[model samples]
Target: MSTATTQGGPELPQERRLVTEIPGPRSRELFARKQSAVPPGIGTTLPVFVTHAGGGVVVDADGNSLIDFGSGIAVTSVGNAAPRVVERVRRQVADFTHTCFMVTPYESYVAVCEKLNALTPGDHDKRTFLVNSGAEAVENAVKVARHATGRQAVVVFEHGYHGRTLLTMTLTAKNMPYKHGFGPFAPEVYRAPLAYPFRWPTGPDACAEEAAAQAIDMIDKQIGAENVAAVLIEPIAGEGGFVVPARGFLPRILEFCRANGIVFIADEVQTGFARTGDLFACEDEGIVPDIICTAKGIAGGLPLAGVTGRADLLDSVHVGGLGGTYGGNPLACEAALGVLETIEQDKLVERARHIGEIMLPRLEALKERYPIVGDVRGRGAMVAIELVKPGTTEPVPAGPIAARCHAEGLLVLTAGTYGNVLRFLPPLVMPDHLLEEGLSILERAISQG
Candidate 1:
């Protein structure tokens, strides 16, 4: 057995066994009930309701096991119901669910923060505060930056996704689903061009220097760097198509921010916690930020987020200024601690690199084989393929191909501003055979297209 599978320690058989159709009879029935009871705003990719999931496969309501490629949007990097996470969560839950960390804090919460402070990239003295979601972490990071600098304007990059809250929505570049019809967005948030090498207007070679220069120029002229509180961006763009900014792009932005005294905040929500081979994606370029926002893979499958930053920047805010009612709840904190342990002990960072080794070449091969595949890019488990019209740069919709994968028992996710990128975020704990099989399924779907 693979080390990852053994460490994830799933009791369920680690095999992709489709006993029935993808969205088998029971799943179809539940989805019907869901349609009537649940709000339409909540969208689902694969309609199969999961009964149990661990290791490489998710068993649906009808006992059909499917290969898990999405990892619940990169939240289950340690694997669903991972042994350590499950054990810790159970003990914490049995002891106490929520005393409201604000009302009565616990040692687990403090422990989780300590882990965050030590683990996140940076040798400087740091402090960490927990939150319920990535949006809250991001919102609070902005608050800290603004409070520390006494500045109003914030700069963000194009194709970067912060979150769905009002301020974060304004920070995000996508329109449909996230920002469409959601007007009256918060002000003082300005967008700048990202060094998206694949789609850069001036082409890939000049993307790094040009995009950085353009962003700095825009901030200086429009927003005025002196007036900017923070420059927030994802280390690897997540929902905006897993776009890794050009090699020199991030370092340049960091230099600009350092010169201007503007806080550089890395929203490492999707790309954090071994998803990008590095523990945090920012570490890949050695571009440490003043404030780092983390969520997704922080607590295994539990909902928890963290803002770990320089002691000076975070401490500048008032004592009462940076907390929430359920922020750092005991159960979630314990889960987070377990997640950290699993990552370190299981060596998931190396596993993520190995997954990249498995995925990138196969995806690159697909790009060479198919005209629709315009680009194949990403660092580790967080890889993607951008689809375009044959012989042109025009984007081709990824919906049909993704649906085909769903029908064939491969759970995949699509992203991109133009809805043309197929992103694959497989769990680090996945077995090798399943990874290869998932790729085969995707190849068939694309070949059909």
Candidate 2:
């Protein structure tokens, strides 16, 4: 409840200051330069270029401080330029950057894996290997699963988002941006129904059981469980919308996986490392996944991911079968170690829960006041409000309202397959004042809409 004790490392002014209009002269000029230099395919959610950031605010090129509710798409949960992260990276960079884990190896890399094995859900002996991104981690997990199970089929859910790589694109559900013209995807990938209470034809009370049964049945009848390698899912769906599956959904799915001998992979890329009230979102169900793919918050702000799972499954693969050139880069590994330490020392897991305690009530209030807000759901700081038509579930485009928030110097983000959800991933270390101010801006934005 008290963020005054939060130390944002860089000693940045916690107060938000708007020196100019959004994307004022300097940022607009920078955007023009970026447009000229960068490819159009590389899109940006906002045109404001960041000059510096720390605590809960991002200072743009125009010297405007905007409250950051996005956390670089959930990358900087420990806060940007966290002291421990910077110190660790500084030491690692000075000594050496990369020696390639598979070749020379490093203690930080092994330490990171050890921490992951200890922190992730299950107690069984686990093995871990690092990767560059969430997509890469998912891909490698699938590879390990197939190799271990001697099966080829991988099942994902509708409204799920894996990544941008070809295989990940195949695993992802939505089209347009992720999987539109990029077809000729990997074969043997199957789709199942998500326990999305908001869109389920059945009501929430019976939705979990119904959807889980339907999904398992489809997989059994269509893909044949024996042929399946893994059932990959996000514990709390991310880009698919911050849709928390109904209570029994994940447990039912995990139960099915157990009976079928299928690997249950919890893709906690966006929800792991204290973003949720728990250390890992899957813990909320007491459902331990056979394989868990993690990234994003694993490192303070560094690019690093890992696949931790049952030792036998990971060990089943041949020696040279796993790992990447930069999979366990020393810098990223050190940064990850720092992140874990910060989480423990700062008690960020508890902080995330406290954030939820503050945010959920405010968001629920908004849902009640605004007809456009159809639902407000999420755990911890990972909260969102789904926008819809006045009296219906029909999506109301969220772009305009999010734009208003941006114009008012609040950095929020839009998610969901249909882009009708506004997700909040505020830093756990964010001061209560910033949190309340950001919410006020959001309320004004939704009101303007």
Candidate 3:
């Protein structure tokens, strides 16, 4: 494996290579060490140990390079080790790492909040509170919603994924892995059906209307709008297979929330920061959520999540009630500033749309060729293909296909509660050729199946 920089000076190889089989020599040794050192509950998508990553490629310890389609589960939107992020983080670390935002506030933290307020979907006066992770952001959003409305109930969708915190786990619908074994979650969280057009018994437009009506009816009958604090949802369901709700669905829900005084929360942890071609996915439907939770890609692989929302709602919480030990570490805030700058200067939002333009046709062709490819959906760069058994709508778990693709040097992720969806979250800066090569590998894997 040769090391050479690209013409653009990004620290990445022009072409990918596989000098050894997956988990070869060095990776095997590292895996053995990891097995002994790391917790078993923390899962890995690929067995290979990542030595270096830049742009859309992850270099393994075994000297194999694979195109990353998962982007660290949608955390590295500006690409892993982007130059801007690296430089900013380095400077911030040298200055200071942490001072505890609660004790001594920093300019960078306030700057990040300013950027979030300016960029997040809403023209109203919005306040932002940075946190350590997506779950923390979700938990804080709940606290603010409850504090603002003096209500206890939070309404979330059936296939929605909030976080792993006790309160968020209760908000999440999945049981086996995320919520399993650690039962007895927090209370007063209600579940509603999302407008999943593929599975719902209606067309996209009608599915949106019906799902909204059903949810409103349920809220009135069961949870009562007055008792609910917020309605939380992912604009495009992330772990639930990139399920894009129909056009009118979010608008109708927003209308209901506004009329009833329930705070509308959009959990954009997976869809924010240009993953869905927009800075926030809610822009597509023209619905500005009252409270928007964001993380993942906000800080370019750093652990920084944010809760940006209506100023009044956020202000309702006591000043001391909304901070963490490392809520907005200096290093993370620097990274976030860099991330936002990168998105704008690099025009990654438009890049996401360009990726979709290239990927959609190829995915459509694959759908035509493979009987198992039941659906192709998602907006911008957050694309997914749902696999199902031929002649029937039964979900065909694509675990084996994903494994084979990983073995052949393509790192992909499976989503959906049934694990039947292959979701792609490639770096927005990925070169066209590399993106096409990854797609070719996907086609080969599916055709082989």
Clashes of 2: 0
User: Model 3: how far is 411 from its true place, Å?
Assistant: 0.4
For each candidate in turn, the TM-score is 0.98, 0.98, 0.97
lDDT of candidate 2 over 1-449, digit per residue (tens): 22222233344677778888887998899889988999988988888999778778888888788899999999999988888888889888999988888888779999999999999998999999999999999999999999999999999998899999999999999897888888899999999999999888878888899999999899989989999999999999999999999999999999989998999999999999999989999999898999999999999888999999999999999989998899989999999999999899999999999999989999899988988999999999899999999888899888999899999989989999888999999998888899999999999998886
Quote the lDDT for 352 in model 2.
97
TM-score for candidate 3, please give it. Answer: 0.97
- Global fold similarity of model 2 (TM-score): 0.98
lDDT of 1 at 101: 77
List candidate 2 stretches off by more than 4 Å: 1-10
Q: After superposition, how far is residue 161 of candidate 2 from its true place, in Å?
A: 0.4
Encode model 3's per-residue lDDT on 103-176: one tens digit a residue.
Answer: 98889999999989998887999999999999999999999999999999999997899889899888888886
Span of ten consecutive residues with least summed lDDT in model 2: 1-10
The count of backbone overlaps in candidate 3 is 0
| Alpha-carbon lDDT of model 3 | 0.89
